[model samples]
Target: MAVPAPSAPAATASFTNAGPAGFWQRAAAWSLDAALVAPFAGWLAWPWIAAPAQAWLDQVRALLQHTGQTMGAAIIDGASLPRLAITLLHDPALHQATAAIRSATWAMVWPALLACALLGAIYHVAGECSPWQASPGKRLLGLHAADRRGRRLGTGRALARYSAGALSWATLNLGHLMATAAPEHLALHDRCSDTRVRAARTGLPRWARAWLVLLAIAGLVASAWLAQAAGTVMQAALERALFWPG
Candidate 1:
């Protein structure tokens, strides 16, 4: 009887030739991720933000009261735009008001901004390093981050990629725009980190397209509502300031 031939081990598959993701795809994914992360970041930063925000509001009210008293009810009630502008420009209190507003605004904003940045960094780094090789937003869009060999990124490489993304922002986003023209569709951070965002599919799925459309509609509606509400509030504040008892 003849001896059976030994079988060879199966070779592992290399990276697919799905190509690099388009700029719009990457942008959409980032936007989605930002939306998902913003609420949590805001919640975490609220404790630090609330006091400064309240202080800023108080300063604004005081400034308005001072302005009303200085300009007097006559000029304000008449709604003389030029006179109002001239008075505001020459008022010494305006300088102090402006300074206080700037200081309070910065104090209220910085903590929230820092929280968002830190949380975003952690989210991106961990997601890219995971077995899925993509953040939830990227995965939803059928995109993944990988090395040249199509291997998933390590934690260090993912972190490096996330950090280098700051360069893209610092460049006024010209670094990010490079993806549109680059032969391989690689952005500055992608090149700096030796990584790529690959599209697992040719185009967006129907569900993603629908979701984007709905999101756009919702955003438009929210913006319109906010603008109307803001206008109403400003009108009310102006009326109160002009008519308030001395």
Candidate 2:
């Protein structure tokens, strides 16, 4: 009698050998990857961004001159500050300028945003499908993506996982937050792609932690500079609007 055929290996076994990565670990990896790609994407999109930005700045300058002239005359004629502010708010020219600037700014930036997104997608897909089964950032964090059987993903599967990440963003990042609550800390995209971000026994490297600290410090300094610049601009504009020769 012929022996029974060997049973096929179960494909549904969960790959739980390593613990799933936490949300903060995944976020840090993504931030590192974004920082790596941002410069190249900015360079590629500069041409599209520059011209419209210049045009918008020119329009803003013209509006500032017109506003100073209009408001200076009103102030000289003894108009109360409250009334002048109300009149300025109701000015058709001011409204037109606001709308024009908004449109121009959006036009100036969409190409750059698109370029960055495309580059990021390419970077993530290639890295995930590579032998390391992780991007440079993820590898730095000791993380890897694997299928249900803990196998490295093929190119197609990696691409699918990346594509499904759009859903995570589309949900306003609620899908990403799901990882905090889900069993094994699997994110929505991880579930959709039948993959998980697994952490190695090792923790984040010292260099990676230092990089994050420096990045935070730089961000804080930049924000402070921007705030000071904006305050100065407003002060200058107010002075011009109030004291311009009428």
Candidate 2 lDDT over residue span 27-130, tens digit each = 77888998899999989999899898898877776567567666666767789999889988999998888888888889888988899889988999888877
| Residue 218, model 2: Cα distance from true site in angstroms | 2.4
Candidate 2 displacement at residue 188 in angstroms: 2.9
Candidate 1, residue 175: the lDDT equals 85
- CA lDDT, every model vs. true structure: 0.80, 0.80
User: How does each model score on TM-score?
Assistant: 0.75, 0.78
Alpha-carbon deviation at 137 in model 1, angstroms: 1.3
The all-Cα superposition gives candidate 1 an RMSD in Å to the true structure of 5.8
